[model samples]
Target: MMLDADQRRTFAALADVLIPASGPMPSATAAGVPDALLDQALGYRPDLAELFAEAVARCTGKDPEAALDTLAAQQPEQFQALTLLTAGAYFLSPRTKAALAYDPPPRSALDDVDSYIDMLSTVVDRGFAIR
Candidate 1:
C-alpha cells in the first residue's frame, strides 16, 4: 500500500485541492494527509488506489479544480470514493478535528437496543437471514 514519491506528490496535490487551506483551517496535506494515511484509508479497496493514481495522472500539469471536474465527469464513482477516502483520512487527524471545532462524544459501553432491533428487522425483511 506504499506509494512512491510521485504518487505521494500527486496525492498531496489532490488532497490540497479537495480540502484547501482557509483562514485557520489547514489544507488536507497540511492536516497530515500523507501517503501512509491514504494507504491505510484505501487499503481495503486496492482497486481504488489504481483508479485514483490514474485519475491523478490525468490531473498532472493541469488546474486542480478543472482536473477534478474532468475526473468527476469521467469517473463519477471513483471520484466520489476517492473524495470520501481523502476527506475521511484528513478529518481523522486531530488537527483537522480541532480546526473544525468538532469534539466527538466518548465511546460508551451501552448499546442502542432499539437501533439493533431495527437493523435486525430490516435485514430479515430483506431476506438476508439464515434460515
Candidate 2:
C-alpha cells in the first residue's frame, strides 16, 4: 500500500497532530510514520482509506489539533482507529524506540514450548479416548 505525495504529506500532518513531539518521544512524522506505513497497517479495513482521505481533506487549512478534536467528536470510531494505527506505526519505528529508551525483549527461544505442550496434550487426549 502506498500514498501519493500529496496524501503522504496530509497523512504526515495528521500524524503530527496525533502524536506531537514531547520531551523524549518525537512527533509521529519525525518517528518515521510515513503514509506507506499507515496504508500498510490500515488498508485492510474497509472504507478506512476513504475515511482518512476525507478527514485529511477536511483538516486542510485548519488547525490540526482543532480539526482532530472535531473529527474525533464527529467520528469517534474512525478517530480511535486512526489513533491506534498511527501509534502502532509510530512506535514500531526505531527512532521512536530509541527516543523512549525502549528495548524490546529478544525473541524467546522457548516459543515452541507452548506448541510442544499442546501437541503432547493432544496426543494424551487421543490415547485416553474411549474409542
Say which candidate scores most in lDDT: 1
Number of colliding residue pairs in model 1: 0
The digit string of per-residue lDDT tens for model 2 on 54-89 reads 666776777778888998999876677667778878
Which runs in model 1 stand beyond 4 Å of their true positions? 106-131
User: lDDT per residue, candidate 1, 22-41, as tens digits?
Assistant: 98788888888865567777
Return the TM-score for each candidate structure: 0.71, 0.67
Each model's lDDT? 0.78, 0.75
The C-alpha local distance difference test score for the whole of candidate 2 amounts to: 0.75
By TM-score, how accurate is candidate 1? 0.71
